[model samples]
Target chain A: MSRYVLRRVVESAVTLILATIVVFAGIRALPGDPARTLAGEESDPATLAAIRATYGLDEPLPVQYLRYVQKAATGDLGRSPRTGLPVAESIGHALPVTLQLAVFAIAIAVLMGIGTGVVAAVRRRRPAEWGANAIALLGLSVPNFWFGQMAILALAIAYPLLPASGFVSVFEDPVESFRHLLMPATVLGTGLAAIIMRQTRSAMLDALTADYVRTARAKGLSSAQVVLGHALRNSLIVVITVVGLQLGALISGAVVTEQLFVLPGFGKLTIDAVFTRDYPMIQGVVLVTATAYIVINLVVDLLYSVIDPRIRVGGPAL
Target chain B: MSLLEVQDLTVRFRTEEGPVLAVDEASFSVATREVVALVGESGCGKSVTALALTDLLPRNASVAGAIQLNGVRPSPRARGRDIAYIFQEPMTSLNPVLTVGRQIGEVLKRHQGASSRARIIELLELVGIPLPGRRIGEYPHQLSGGMRQRVMIAMAVACRPKLLVADEPTTALDVTVQAGILDVLRNLRDEIGTALLLITHDLGVVADIADRVVVMYAGRVIEQAGVHRLFAHPTHPYTRGLLDAVPTPGRPVLKEIPGRVPVMRATSDACTFADRCWRVTEQCRSVRPVLEPGPAGHPARCWHPLGGKE
Candidate 1:
């Protein structure tokens, strides 16, 4: 297990390096120059030169990549071109908000999805299965952005129940922060829940038909025990994989949701940086998202051993 | 009195194409301290009949007629405590995610309510799994195929069921391992005195372990007699064909049963085996022959018995 973990960590590091190179190349290849975007038309050439030099934008591509790698290795993500603030510091401030939203959304999605999945699988051929399936379809079909806008319109503008936009720090007042987060989380989480629920239901249905389940029943176990004991444990592996893949999407979803709710999360920060051409902030956010994706997959892969011992990470046993 | 008496039991599956008759009105019994082998080829409803005994048939299947266990008609919903089924594929029969001990312990907890750790270990050791203390923590995938089948047997016998139905238990195993598994089952029968219902297509396996044998063809029992009588002087043409098919060492080239078992399209009013029988006649094709005594308490389902001595 330790060897497996070590191997995964090394693979993740390589993935992160590849991702950094790709993101850097793509951003640098964009049409508009960062120097031009930073300095307006009224600025003198010398001032532009100075600005470019200060940001190290005038360096060769190879040299610029080296500096970028160096800074990332040391946890210094350079300074934002728009705000002229340290990119790491800006992201640090925004990350907590995004993390809070993502965690809450995922928690709700997993709980509700797995619960409804178990119910649907157990009550197969019943009205509950149809109802759960319908809900899942609705969740999958409705876009998160549209859902967010509709939720804001319905709950904030018309009903006047929730605050329409803006975020409150949880440290200031936990209850107020929760209230601010509730609607966005619901909108973002609904789609994830639907996906997970559908997968879980399907996996559970397949597991229930397995020979072991029949053996469990032949042992005189009750219907509930047969489903939960034999079916659910095996079915959870697929659900876990789906949930892990969704973590990346959840972070991405938080960006649009944060914008709608006016929450200062990584999503909102990245969007702001994109509009102003803040290369440092944009790179920093992308790096963090990439890291999150790699790490979540690594964790999910490690969990496979615990869920089903037959899956060995280091290839077939020697 | 027989420990298990299944009389005129019929099982059918409702498929999208049509209603397929899986197990045609089959009747047989297992007496206490006796081993009865239900022998047949694949798709002859041998496994389905065993499954029906424990109400383990699939959802679309409809089972009718009487299945009395210890004088009580056991329903599909309430059969586990009295009748337990060991399926063909031992590799898949045990839960992959669960430990062998827990899988066996589940039967105890469910039927006998034996929840103590010590009791589970005791049951594990009883099935010949080594180092029950350390091995109890290992999952089904950790064990070998033979060990897994032992775990399956342990689970089936956990409740001390009156009748144990083994559906081709050794079919998935190698020849050498097959004998060991059969020995384990035979020993269990001798030790616990539980009536054993062994279902298989292998005549050689039945010859070695079974006291009585019921030969089936086209989802119907064609012959049943003591093992000695069936082997020494077989009656039904299907039984004779099955015996002829088994290859014997140092014997001249074996006789093969020409053509496959006929598929039952509609409920047969005539002999189901008439299509494949070399001695088939107009009467054989026109009238279905029910089981009747041949010799030495042997019952053969045929108009004309094979082996003229009978």
Candidate 2:
């Protein structure tokens, strides 16, 4: 098991390096030059040269990349030209907000998704299942931005129950933080919740019909026990896989949601970095995002072994 | 009184195609510790009948008739407490995600509301799972087909259910592994006096473990007799066709009962096997023959039943 983890860590390292290269090349490929973007309009020629030299834009791409990697290894991510703040510090500030939102989103998605999915499957062909299905369809079909607006208008504008768009630190006040992030988190989580529901419902349907389920039923377990203990647990392996893959979507959704809510998160930081072409901030954010993906996938792999003993025998999918 | 009595049991599924009859007035009983085999071809309603015994059929199914244990209907509480089921696919019959111990423990827990680790180990040992201590920690996928079936048997017998309804327990196993599972089930019956309802298509399996055999054709109980008597006398034409289809040492080529079972329409209108029977008579087509004793005093639902000579 440790060997499997060690191997994954090595693989993650390789992927991170590849991601850095892609991010560097991708940013460089953009029409606007970092030197030009950093050196403002009406700047003299000497100023441009000085900016280029200072940022190592004058160096060969490989040399610059190696320098970037070296500094990055030593916990230096350079300063953003836009904010003139350390890239790492900017990300540090934004990371917590997005992390909290992500945690909230995941919690909401799993509870809503699995809960409804079990209900639909157990009450299959009934009115409850139909209602759940209709809700899932609507959730999947509706646009997030539009949903966000409607939610803000209804909850914030019409009723004035919540602050329309803002951010609050959970460490400061947990309940207030929940109230603040609830709208954006739900809007972001809606798509994932719908997806998990669809997957869980189908998986659960299959599980409910499985031979094991029959054995469970014949054991005289209540309908709830049979569905939850026997069927739902079996279906969770599929649900876990879906949650792992859909996390990328959640991250992307955060990009849109955080911006709409005007919360100072990695999403807003990323968008602003792209619009203004702040190369350091962009690289730092992408690197952290890539690292997060790699780590979460590794965690997902570990979770598979926990949920399914079969995976332990085969040592997972390499 | 019999340990189990299933009388006039009927099951139909409401599907998009239509209301399909899966089991039709199927009646049988298993006396205390008796091993009764319900044998038939695929789609002949054997599995459905077994599921109906425990109210285990799918939501689309509507079941009618009586399933009584010990002279009273087996209530919902009778499941796993008085009766337990082992399905055909041992590969799938045991939950893949759970340890063998946990699966078996669940039965004890459901009925008794408390289960000890020691009792679980004992059940595993009773089913002949090697290294019950270690096997308890392992999941279904880790075990071989035979071992998984043993685990299923252990779970079924955890509460010492009066009857263990095993639906084709050996069908998914290898030829070599099949005997071991059958032996485990037989041991279950012999050791605990647990009545066994063995559902299968294999006559060889019927010959192996069953004391009496009930033959089904197109959702109807076409024949029922002592296993040896049924195999020896082989009264009904369909029963003869089935027995004759089995190869003997002297036979040059194996005989096969041709034609698939009909997509039944109005079950009682005629003999369900008439279309597939070589000796099918006009009477066989015009009316349904209830199960009645033939000239040999052997019960078979047929217009013409063979005499006692094979």
Residue pairs with clashing backbones, model 2 = none
Best by lDDT: 2
Q: State how far residue B260 of model 2 sits from its true place (Å).
A: 2.2
lDDT of 1 at A83: 85
lDDT of 2 by residue, B167-245 (tens): 8999999988999888888888889989999999898999999999999988899999999999988888888888877
lDDT of 1 by residue, B1-310 (tens): 8888989888888888888888788999999979999998887888888888877787889989898987988865455667877888888888888877777777777777666679878767877788989878877777778888888887788777788899899999989889888988888888887779999989889999999998888889889999998998888888888888899888878998777876565678899888788888899988989899875458889888886553
List the global CA lDDT of all models: 0.85, 0.88
Model 1 interface RMSD over true interface Cα atoms: 2.4
lDDT, candidate 1, at A76: 98
TM-score per prediction, in order, is 0.94, 0.96
Candidate 2 per-residue lDDT over residues A55-126, each given as its tens digit? 788999999999999999988999887898999999999999999999999999999999999889888889
Please list the residue runs of candidate 1 whose C-alpha ends up more than 4 Å from where it truly belongs after superposition: A158-161, A168-174, A313-318, B75-80, B307-310
